[model samples]
Target: MALSLWRSVFGGSTNAPEDGGVAFWSSPERAGWLTKQGEYIKTWRRRWFVLKHGKLFWFKNSVVTRASIPRGVIPVASCLTVKGAEDTLNRAFAFEISTRAETMYFIADSEKEKEEWINSIGRSIVQQSRCLADAEVVDYGSSEKR
Candidate 1:
């Protein structure tokens, strides 16, 4: 039921691969190539990013399957802000996703791409937060009834 809704919205399968390769049915809300800053080295590396189910996942390449593990994953619900940081980074298409712990930087291919990524992440954060709130409400109501 939930998987069906996820597929309906993202247009991908949730099934694991039969051969233990990539899960071809895994559909993302948004996917593209972007350059991301390395956490320790402070260097930028090109990566393939997929946004789905209120999570942002990056891989070495776009050929994601069930066997392919993400290089990094960011839970959108934990994010505090998503905004362009071109001037601060001195990069043309740079943006930032900031959480309480740290701020991650990324550079898109163009201005439109940068804005689109920011918007997508912002929407995911809002959606995830709302889901959390809805769950809390349900729990509160159930406890009251009990």
Candidate 2:
């Protein structure tokens, strides 16, 4: 199974970088990715909002299963969870994490637009068996803390 470095950055795995902004990490089956907690096992799920045609097409970051979300138009960013591959594919929770920059997609433009789009879809994307607990939060330094 192939995982991305984003999972590691989110504390999903600590295995260092490999190439193309992508890294290899070992995630679990059921849902979240697996990380070693001092020899013990810790499961963490990543989540993100996907935007297609200026709307919330889906929300997943772990092991989500669904058909390939077609990039109907230029995406304007997203706030969905990110994760490694294999476990997330097909599962509504898993998303093949990537370091390709393009994969760092979040929000449809503004959080407001995203919320509106999501709400328009019935606000069911955030339902259980869909939305997973976020990975440990971190400061990536983007919103002006530079």
Looking at candidate 2, the ten consecutive residues that score lowest on lDDT are 28-37
lDDT of 1 by residue, 1-146 (tens): 22333343334544432222323328788899999998778989999998877777677898987677566667677789999999989989999999887888999999999999999999999999999988877544456553
lDDT (0-100) at residue 99 of candidate 2? 26
Sliding window of 10 residues with minimal summed lDDT for model 1 = 16-25
TM-score of model 1 (CA atoms): 0.78
Count of clashes, each model? 5, 25
* Local error of candidate 1 at residue 98 (angstroms): 0.3
Off by over 4 Å in 1: 1-25, 138-146
lDDT agreement with native, every candidate: 0.77, 0.29
* Candidate 2 segments exceeding 4 Å error: 1-104, 117-122, 128-146
Highest-TM-score candidate: 1
Q: What's model 2's overall lDDT?
A: 0.29
